[model samples]
Target: MYPKILICDDVVYSRTMLKNILDQIGQYIIVEVENGKELISELLKSRETGAEFSYLFLDLELRREDGISLLREVRKMEPLLKIFLSGGISLTDENIKKGIDLGVKGFVSKPYKSKHVKTIFKSV
Candidate 1:
């Protein structure tokens, strides 16, 4: 199975920033989507091709859909998926708990930093 990286964020700049960081670290095939619908579509397409994401960088706040809801659906499909929440807003404890309950692996706050990215990769 080919390793994939999925990035779901409504903000173009956020996706670009993360992509740049990933590109700097290695040659990864990163995919980007602006909404939950697109995210689902991409996941399905990847699955059909016998591929799974090594990690998913999902934004908590999308333009039209909540990421957590999508996360629930995705968890059912890829139970072992590595998911990281991202957003400009600080996640409350309750929300963080909710994410954990839904099987998210971690959170990546906005204004991306090298250290945060490094930590996530190190775990892998």
Candidate 2:
């Protein structure tokens, strides 16, 4: 089966851009959400269906909620979930450290690159 990927970003452009890149890499079951609430909902649904997502591309700066806080909650719900963080200017050193501490797999900044995304896709 194709790997499942969940992308949560408040910005429409960011989510679309990342989805496009992943589409180019290979076959994947990709789901997009605009906020943490939707993301959590998706996760719960996956758990109920017995088809957990293989990866998560989460944004560090969400308009309605804090990404790190959301990440903390996600970790509790799905401790083994492979999470990669994304952000533009708000991707600071401290936040990166916090995410690392919270057990994120890695990070990809804004303006998602196809090559970088491919590498991440392969690693997972």
Candidate 3:
């Protein structure tokens, strides 16, 4: 089966851009969520159905939820999941370190670029 790639971003434009970039790389089932609650719900549903996403690109500044908190919960449930973070704000070294501490595989700064997308895919 084609691998599923999950994208959790609050911005519609960002999600579309990411989906388009990933589509250029390979065939993948790209799942999208606009908030933390949907992110959790989708992950749980996927796990139960044996359709867990192969990669997750999460926005650092999700609406109404702390990304770090959400990441912690996701790590608890899916320790092996490959996760990456993205944000409009420039990623500080501290923020990157925090994500790394939480088991993030990589980070992609917005707006999405072919090179950044390619790098994350390769790293994962």
Candidate 4:
């Protein structure tokens, strides 16, 4: 199935940033959220509507809550969804361990490269 991507970041610019990259993918339907709260809410709503979430680009830090908290909840509710974490969380062993436990697909940075986004979309 063609994946529907969700971008969740507290920073307005960061959300716009990935939205631009995901738009270039042509096939995947991209959705945007401002924080973990909105992300979880949308996930729940989408679940009710039978719209599957395929990819999620989540920022680790948020004013209201952390994406890891949302990640944990997503695993419980939507285990099949693939997640990508960016900004405020390093790709460290501990973080990778946590993300892998929930089946994260990949990651991008705050200042993501266009070429890398192109490559990743092609590969996925």
Candidate 5:
């Protein structure tokens, strides 16, 4: 079966862009969530169903909550989930360090590129 990928971003365009990039790289079951609540709901459902996503591309700043805070909660629930931060602005060193400390696998800068997405997908 194709691996599933979850993308959490407030902006619809950002989610579409990332989905497009992933589509170019390979076939994947891509799911999009607009905020932390939806993200958590999906994660919970995945856990209950035993169909957890293989990857998550989470935006650093959501409309309601920041990704770091959400990451903390996620770690407590799904500690082994592979997460990548997607930031539109350049992330501060401190924030990056915090994310690393929290178990972020890597980062994908805004305006997603197909090449970079391909590399990340292949590596992991």
Candidate 6:
């Protein structure tokens, strides 16, 4: 079965680009969200239907909210979920340390890299 991916990024262009690559891979169910707020809301709503996403692809900087907060909240709610951080924003060593501290599965710097993403999802 294909792995499911929930992609949360504020930028339309970025989301579209990521979608194209993931679609080509044909091994992932990519669900796109505009930001952390929307992602969290969808997650809560999905509980009624008992649906869950397998992988999370999140942007660091977002419109009106930050992905880190969502990450933190999700960790608190579902600690075992896999997460892949992606965006133009670069986390400092300190920030990376903090993310590692949070137990995030992976960190990906964007403008989307198809090969890297494919390699990554394959390994998982």
Global lDDT scores for all candidate models? 0.84, 0.91, 0.89, 0.76, 0.87, 0.77
Candidate 3 lDDT over 19-60, as tens digits, reads 999999999999999998898899999999998888899998
Which tens-of-lDDT digit does each residue in 7-116 have in candidate 2?
Answer: 99988988999999988888999999999999999999999999899999999889989999999999999999999999988789999899999988888878888888
Q: Which sections of candidate 5 miss by over 4 Å?
A: none
A best-first ranking of the candidates according to their lDDT comes to 2, 3, 5, 1, 6, 4
Error of 2 at 2 (Å): 1.2
Top-scoring candidate (lDDT): 2
TM-score of 2: 0.94
TM-score per candidate, chains pooled: 0.91, 0.94, 0.95, 0.85, 0.94, 0.87
Q: Model 5, poorest ten-residue lDDT window?
A: 86-95
Q: What's model 1's TM-score?
A: 0.91
How far residue 103's Cα lies from its native spot in candidate 5, in Å, is: 1.3
What is the per-residue lDDT of model 4 for residues 30-53, given as tens digits with 9 covering 90 to 100? 888887668879899889989878
Per-residue lDDT over 62-120 for candidate 1, one digit per residue giving the tens place of the 0 to 100 score: 87887778888888988888898887674777778889898788777788887898687
Write one digit per residue (lDDT tens) for candidate 5, span 1-124.
Answer: 8989999999999999999998888899999999999999999999999999989998987877978889899888888999898886746788789889988888888788878877776777
Per-residue accuracy of model 6 over 27-83 as CA lDDT, tens digit each: 676788997668888677656666777878878788787667777987886677788
| Distance from true location, Cα of 89 in model 3, Å | 1.8
Q: Look at candidate 4 and tell me the lDDT of residue 75.
A: 79
